[model samples]
Target: MSAFARSFLKKSLLAASTLLLGMPALAEEAASASLSNPFICRRPSGAAGTITEFPLPTEESSPTSITVGPDLNLWFTQTGTGTIGRMTRDGAVTEFPLPTEYSIPQKITPGFDGNLWFTQLGVNQVGRITPKGVVTEFPLPSAGSSPYGIAAGLDGNLWFTQVTGNRIGRITPAGVVTEFPLPTPEAQPTAIALGAGGKLWFTEVRGNKVGAIATDGTLTEYTVPTANAGPSSITLGWDGAMWFTEQFAGKIGRIGADGTITEYALPDANSGPVDITVGPDGALWFVELRGNRVGRITVSGALTEYDVPTAGSQPAGIVFAPPGFLCVDPHLWFTERGSNQLGRIRAVTVP
Candidate 1:
């Protein structure tokens, strides 16, 4: 862990112990908690009673993203090691070295054609990997592009952010690439997800806006009401609005398809929300990299926070993994950037 994280953990542990000691009768009420340095949590569908933590190869290598691969295994990106890792439902782990040869792989997502697509933030290249672990890479058309986040587009292609290039890129399943520049320079688009409306939605970390692009590479930008909000990750919500995290401003934002934007403040002023996803339970779940918590924002904009066992752990990525009753496994899987551990949170029915 970073020195900052180590110190924060110490303080958090002290606080947790005090919280426990101060209420002797609360022992039975303490939720079951597990993590070497647990970072993020998700509750997979149908598997409501079990939680699983998938450890990384190292204690300091940050795993950045996780998604259910077409092969039915979980695929994640290791930003610290510049590798892609695969962990099967039965707990088998395999890894593939990144092809960029210069930069770390930042984000990863499932492509339309059943391959895993990822971005190389340091080298400006996009990569593809198959269920069998075959990897292919395509160099960005622009120099210093610094591709960050990626997601499958409705057009049977992969769309990604060129954070430094100030553009978004589209790559067909066959690996052909096309680039579209944003109207403003240095937008630093960070994360992207295919919107319900068949368009690609993304966050501009520097530009402080949520933008969209059609399959034809047309660009549209919507400014957030707050300044330096640092909008980071964007995802389609169950409610038909696009939900995003404002990393610096400590709020969640929603954008209508017509280009209107609304912001909701988190309970904490510095949650530093990074990535978000719509859960099966119909809540908007996101990682709080700074506040050290899992944030749940309801469709109606109600905010709830859950503290991870480890503090300052820097949860970065999240995904749902529902195991049936026969397997006895179900929960959400997430990654911790500061602790180099996987986090799992189970859903509890409200009393």
Candidate 2:
């Protein structure tokens, strides 16, 4: 078997053995990897089996956000097309028309009420779609506010950012939006996620800060140590901290519930880490957008980079698949913006 295939199998077997024995698993989940031990396979053959790319024919199209839909299909936004696209688990692709022109759809997420919610950046709107593809759009009160990132809040509301208006907006499942202005006007909040602590955590891209707003509208902000760090995306870390990516400073940052901030520099300068998510193995997994690679960092802050075989692939928006058999553990899925493809990594081993 090939080096990658063997490594994948080894990892899969290790995972299976641990599970069968009812022992606690400890290895960190990785999105991708290269073999360091020729005899020890690090990723399984079936895990890295095939990669598929889907192209949207719209002008200057790029995917902004992606999420698993209620139907188990992967749904994402096509910014340039003013449309949403869906990819089946078996690789079938379908596109749905948006309700407005120049919608510039940014982020797509599964809402509390089981609808697919997306941000319409250019048109200042939030959209929802049922499992059958019926779309409902809610217009933001502030024109040109540029609603960018979105997530389902703990209170069952859809929360998003106004990249231009410097505000956070909340929408009821019924499409009623109420805008909350951030303290620092024009801070340009980019992405948001719900914390385990029940607060909405987000990144202020232009303001260079990570902030949290309670479900009741109280806001707190934390400044990173590096200037112009450009905090872009935030997710709840398995280590019980909020982890965010510094798009400009090329670092990963951690913020505690009490507002303490720490930063970890990437091995490569200008790596431009963009999005992050909590892995099933309890590590933080992120996308190195400029480096065209997927990376994983343990709770202790150790960084490992995986080189993608395809150059300039631009990995973005990563997530771990729901648990399954040897063919599916630690499975990672991400977007390849430059190539317009969806990529997966399976049976990943840290060592």
Candidate 3:
């Protein structure tokens, strides 16, 4: 546990004792309350936005990654159930099964070919699904590469991380595949994103570093400041820098085009921030798997967090939709891995 968490627990115990000494009835209520506060994301009437959730039709589906499709619908991976789920704006859900059983699909993104692509760790293949729900699969160059995170590159191809392959893999829209070896072995990369300057950036969770690959395939890696930080997600921030989450260290990290890295500690050092994205309001938003809350941070380092309505939701992935871009209700979307639900906070546009 972080020192802050230990200290907070100690103080809470002392305060509870004081309350129990005077008022037994009141002390019972206090004792039953959770140590950390939980709130459904909401603001005055229609100000910040209210949170809404849609439960999946199947149990233990374990949805992992979520993305807004070119069709303006939400697409997600059901790792547990081995299916791809699509939800309309009104919460109507449809599921499509992968061709291979035990596919163990991971992160997903809209591809340059007007389709959505995802990683299949269990079957060791890259899968694609058209907007019409047709499925296609391509095997990785090597066996058991464990392709995890994927993103559309500036070169009209898809780029993804090979968690165990120790290399970056790219697949063209035509299904031709190529692999680029990483200088560092066993990096265990987890998530990827297209960042500033048309470069594809990814997290090296085990290597404790962040790497960038130009469309031409030249790769460069920058070391994170903290040891064993376990960076988990990467995104292109509104400020023209690459922002990411340090899951192990409970910090939000930033890397500039020049490869300079900066880190900011969260209010709750044990929050275990997972996936991050750029919100419609131009701030960086992230999911706190351990904190059970969604956090927002500004370019200047100021932070704010809103608790998930479902206790122990264990939010795993997050994505942002711009106001009126495709539909009337723009939202900050996420997957509730623990609760088996998809969630969204109503989005407010900044004039």
Maximum-lDDT candidate = 3
| True-structure RMSD, every candidate | 11.5, 8.9, 14.4
Give the C-alpha miss distance for residue 195 in model 3, angstroms. Answer: 1.3
For model 2, how does the per-residue alpha-carbon lDDT over 260-347 read when each residue is reduced to its tens digit?
8988999876989999986655578888889887888877898877766578878777775523233234566777777666666542
lDDT of 3 at 280: 54
Question: Global lDDT for candidate 2?
Answer: 0.76
Taking all chains together, the TM-score of candidate 2 against the true structure is 0.82
Which digits, one per residue and each the tens of the lDDT, describe model 3 over residues 1-351? 335434433443343343234322121223333312221111223545467788899999998899977665789999999899998755679999999999999998987567899999999999999988999999887998999999988677899999999889999988899999998889998888998688999999999999999988899999999999999999988788999999999999999999999999998888999999877565788999999888888888888888899998889999874122111233589999999999887545322
* TM-score per candidate: 0.82, 0.82, 0.85
List where candidate 1 sits over 4 angstroms from the true fold: 1-52, 322-330, 348-351
lDDT for residue 280 in candidate 1, whole number 0-100: 45
Model 2 misplacement above 4 A: 1-60, 322-329, 347-351
Candidate 2 residue pairs that clash: 6-41, 7-41, 7-42, 7-43, 8-43, 8-44, 9-44
Worst 10 residues of 3 by lDDT: 35-44
lDDT per residue (tens digit) for residues 124-155 in model 1: 78999988889998887789888898988767
lDDT of each: 0.76, 0.76, 0.82
User: How do all the candidates rank in terms of TM-score, highest first?
Assistant: 3, 2, 1
Give the runs in model 3 whose Cα sits over 4 Å from its true position.
1-45, 322-330, 347-351
In model 1, residue pairs whose N, Cα or C atoms come closer than 3 Å (at least 3 residues apart or on different chains), thus clashing, are 42-332, 43-332, 44-331
